[model samples]
Target: MLKKQKVSLVVLTLLLLLNIVGILNSTQYLLKILFSYFVLIIAITFLPFLRQKINYSYKLQEILFGLPMILPIFLFKLKTISFAIGKLKHFEIFLIYLLFLAVVLLLLHHKDYRMKSSSPFIKLSISKKEVFLTILGMVYSIFTEEMYFRFFILSELEDYSYYLKIVFLVFSSFLFVGAHYLNKWAASMFTYKNYISQFILSMLSGNIFLVTNSLFYSLILHIAYNFPEIWLILKRLKYQQLHYENDGAFFDDY
Candidate 1:
């Protein structure tokens, strides 16, 4: 393996091992700092010093510029973002997102459907602005992940036999899905739909990369897969906020 490939593989493998230990012991302390972790990944992965002179098709060489998105987390407590929900198409698109979420939920975890219940903790746990930032952060992380698991890994193995490349891709995709299991910070996040989404993404991302040789399409797929979880998050938060305003209760359900 090349020096860079060795570094990438070791780093990802160490993370997987850490998550495995976390799963066994139920330690998610790292989960709280995941935003910072993603920031670091985006920075180091694209940094010229840590990587070789490999040109990328996606042109993400300057990803450090996006680190400023974290400023909202530390500097501001923005209550509202306009979210610009006043438009007609915005509602239409939101409805589409809801429809998609419903279909997936029914198909995957229909037996244990408990979405009707509101989460009181969520009202105080996160805010609308944070959720919006999370959505953007999610997008950036998706791109970063696909770039690592698809483009960089596969590219490093390009000199190997085609069959060997397939094997590595399959293994890498497995690691990718397994990482999602480590990201199970909430019950809603680890639903059957979420697991299935990860599995499908693990397979499809590799196939897409193999066929198209670009992370752009796989990045889109990853984001699309997370839509259900994202919707549920927003739903609970919106519910809590409305109740908070109308009832003036301390930490009531959303």
Candidate 2:
């Protein structure tokens, strides 16, 4: 990037960060999305590569491919796994499956982030069924975000100088971390200590897209890296829900 471009990029990166942080207190999901898109619109106007009309035909094709996954989310909402399990034995089968998932998640997050809570930003007193639903919802979000960042955001910087792309890479990584702060679990999830892993994971997803030019590869990585944090969030919700239930089953190992 030219010296002036570098300076301007710094200013825009800060503006974008501020825009993201502005949604920190917002609880309405749809409105936060609108505000972020508004910022992106303003950003593209100043960004030379983005000043031209963007070809969203690619986005349309992606949505088509994503439909197979989208259908299951709706099915889960209609009739969840928790709804089918009746006996303790059945629940054990479910729990065993989740344990396998937990093993994969542990490989992703390591064990250090299991710190005791500093109180949540907002508590969700949710149930087993709700936990599955929330995770299904996160699956949808992972798809949306991978499309937005690895696909759309990176496309905006195509052919830009390598240094500028790296800057945007870091900026995009922070955007992922900023998203956690926007969550109800923010108080614990967005602590600066976790930023290192989050950045590495974000960069890994971003760089993989650049290498393969395929959202499919990057999307899977995003899900793999994020599943552990999602598990932690679900566990915390369960932990908080226990406060309201006299007979809540406790899983001591999480």
Candidate 3:
């Protein structure tokens, strides 16, 4: 087993609050700061120069250091009460997600679990604004997802049998992707392929995130994926609200 830090109850509580507040505000500032910190942590992990300079005895010190920074994002996502209502109204979709996750778990256990690289595609240049937004999303994903699934769920499920641990790991991964799919499907932002890809990606990503004991890389990738789409959605909502208010004002004038 990797040398692990026993996170204190006080620390965990604080981390949860930080992650939740950051996401709830939908602000990019904290996100950017988190991504920057993630990069720093990643660098310190791989670079001997930085590693030697730091006064830490633990191999996974970066993970612990990041917890306080990451907690808010986790708390922010859970702060919303939408999940309670959605699960009630969209029971079929919910069941389908669970079923699909079971299939993914079975597939993972099969011999063909190795990853295959996709064909090379043209890449877009990263704009400053895009970079900024992605960093935000990265912060949000890293803190919130890691805390909820890897830390909170895993810690709580520790009492289960070894077989159950495996099952929980697989199911937790599925639930993570399924949650995204349900929300994205309702928002009309995600494709069927997108959900499938994300599910696979989440499984792989979760393993790496836990293994490295650093949520930084996972945060970067998620934020990069989510930033553009979320920005567009917010802009659209703002535009519609403005249009509606102006129309109301015009009627009043007439």
Candidate 4:
């Protein structure tokens, strides 16, 4: 068991490093797709080994409890879209406030603030095909991440004492955050705020896996948390393209 744990840790660490490289170096669609496939292959190859270690049963309740914690962030994104569309009526704003309050209360009741601590910034100029590929890549990447960080890393420490577990969790979470920071775009804007937020997300994700004993739950939460960021980025990209086209046409007419 010890030997297997050590080997898995080494493999996961190397994979994380490779993933960072892929993120940093892949500047075009083909390169990005290649890297994504590379990660997916590694993840799929290790799936069986990781699956054996997971004992958590899938229950509807886990999703039910976890989904609402994400509502506030989605609401915030929706509020942005609403503002973009037109002026929000007084009643609409008031209703949004009420919804936000309710979601906060629910999160507090469930102690889900950990999941709410951070948001990911996805700043990529991707085409429509790349967007589709990116979504698929993200899904696969999330699976691999849960397998490595949550299942393989965490399970390896299960037999140890609580202090050791906590230490390993923090250590792994730091590595997880470091991997994100390695992305070329993210690294340029890296701040303590991003670091802290990623740490919080990593910790919460690990805890969710521990509690639910299911990587699926962690993956679901991860996707739910990240989807809005992707949506926001796409919206911004579309708006920018429109503005650029309009400016070009105006100059051409003049």
Candidate 5:
């Protein structure tokens, strides 16, 4: 496991180097290499094909991916650091509410993200209080991360056509998944059902951002993307209660 993890780290480092140089060179070959690296990370980390067990490889990938994901946001925050930090203006409040509504709808429809009996994210001791806390943490974590990745980063890329924007969103999400592949490889794998769902969702959200000229919608969608985890926690809490009352009838035969 340790050897496999070391190799994984090496691969991650090489990919980062290739990505940095490739971004600067802007050559097709470099882009191809970077893309391949991203795919490899996805396969080895997420797909069962690899037969390699590395301790918390997915979690490590999340941290690794998260750094690059957060960098653009950090730069934006720095650029705006000296700006006013006053009370919310009317327009700002309206935008916030709109974002919130989108989030609610997005969460309601998101299915794969929800916890299932066999999902890795579901733990045994979940309670209502823990569910709420996890939901809050997941929302905040995804919101800040999305603000940087989807909203701010997309804003940086030139969106000359809807096609270009779509390309960027898919590519960005690909990288986004790659960076955090360690934590959620299932969602990151291009071949996974959830991956396809997220890809389509991201493409739609990107187009919506372009059409509406509103970053608020994108922000809400980003937060809503995390609804699956929230749903899972809540489900676990309810299931625990029911199971307790039922005297383990569900598992008693086993």
Candidate 6:
């Protein structure tokens, strides 16, 4: 079992390195997209095997308790939910889940606000293939990331002391954010916003995994958080195409 854990950790680390290289190297878009899906498939396969081998127990209570951890941008809201959960009845787990959905919606609104105000209107000439690949890559990338940082790394440190857990959390969060920082999309004037958001989400996802003992909660939150950003990107691409055809040299203006 120990040997398996060690091997799993090594594999995850190597995968992380490969993912970073895929982001940093100026590769073809299709290749990058394919690589992202490949890494995600490996992560999805390995995480479940490792979890079973390690006998990781997931509890319904922990999953409910962890739902509020998604509101990392609103710490006070999370704290309130955490406090309220203890007083609620066992049947109120459903209520808590409903509340979690509400919080997710609110967070999505907040994300939309930030994205509208901060994200640059890049005049992209993306084809249908590129659009499909980008969306697939984004979803796959998120899955791979949550599997590695939350399920693999954080789960392994579960038996450690609080201090040790915190140390690993910070280390893993740095790696998560660093991966994004190295990405081509984030290497721009507005890069700091991406870095800050990624760091906070990484920390929050780690905490969610700690509380829930399940990767599903964090994975849902990650996808919810990214949905608006992806939509905006697609909308902008469509808008850019319309204007580019209407006015020649429209791309040059941006």
In order, what lDDT does every prediction score?
0.53, 0.53, 0.44, 0.49, 0.52, 0.54
Q: For residues 1-254, could you state the per-residue lDDT of candidate 2 as single tens digits?
A: 23433444466566556656893343333233334543443332333333235644533433433443334334323222121224455445434434554464466445444442334622656556556556766677688667555555554455678897787787677766654433333455455646655666677667655544556556666677666557677666767666766534443235
Task: Show pairs that collide, candidate 4.
Answer: none
Give lDDT tens digits, candidate 6, residues 1-254: 23434454465566556657775453343233234433433443344455567766533222322332222213222112121222234324434543564464555456655657455654555555556656766666676567556655565565689998888788778767754543323445335655666666677767766766666657666876687667766776776677666434423434
Against the hidden reference, what TM-scores do the models get?
A: 0.47, 0.44, 0.35, 0.43, 0.51, 0.46
Tell me how many clashing residue pairs each candidate has.
2, 0, 12, 0, 5, 0
Name the runs in model 4 displaced over 4 angstroms: 1-128, 233-254
Q: What is candidate 3's lDDT per residue for 1-254, written digit by digit as tens? A: 11111222233345446777774452343343334333333332334444457866533443443454345445444322111222232444334444554465445432322211111211222333444454455555456665555544443333557676566567657656644543312346555555665666565545434434344444444454444445444444445455444323322433
How much does each candidate deviate from the true structure in C-alpha RMSD? 15.3, 16.1, 20.8, 18.3, 9.2, 16.7
Model 4: worst 10 consecutive residues (lDDT sum): 78-87
Q: Between candidates 2 and 3, which one is better according to TM-score?
A: 2
Q: Give the TM-score ranking, best first.
A: 5, 1, 6, 2, 4, 3
Candidate 1 global Cα RMSD: 15.3
Model 2 regions lying over 4 Å from their true place: 1-109, 112-128, 182-185, 229-254
Better of 3 and 5 by TM-score: 5
The worst-scoring run of ten residues by lDDT in candidate 1 lies at 76-85
Better of 1 and 5 by TM-score: 5
lDDT by residue (tens digit), candidate 4, 143-230: 6566555665565444568787677678668767755544324546556655665676677667655544555555655665456446
Q: Report the CA-based lDDT of candidate 5 relative to the real structure.
A: 0.52
Where model 5 places Cα greater than 4 Å from the true spot, the runs are 1-24, 27-68, 76-123, 158-163, 180-191, 239-254
Model 5 steric clash pairs = 58-182, 58-183, 65-179, 113-228, 114-228
Clashes of 3: 12
Those runs of model 3 whose alpha carbons end farther than 4 Å from true positions after fitting are: 1-131, 157-160, 184-187, 209-254
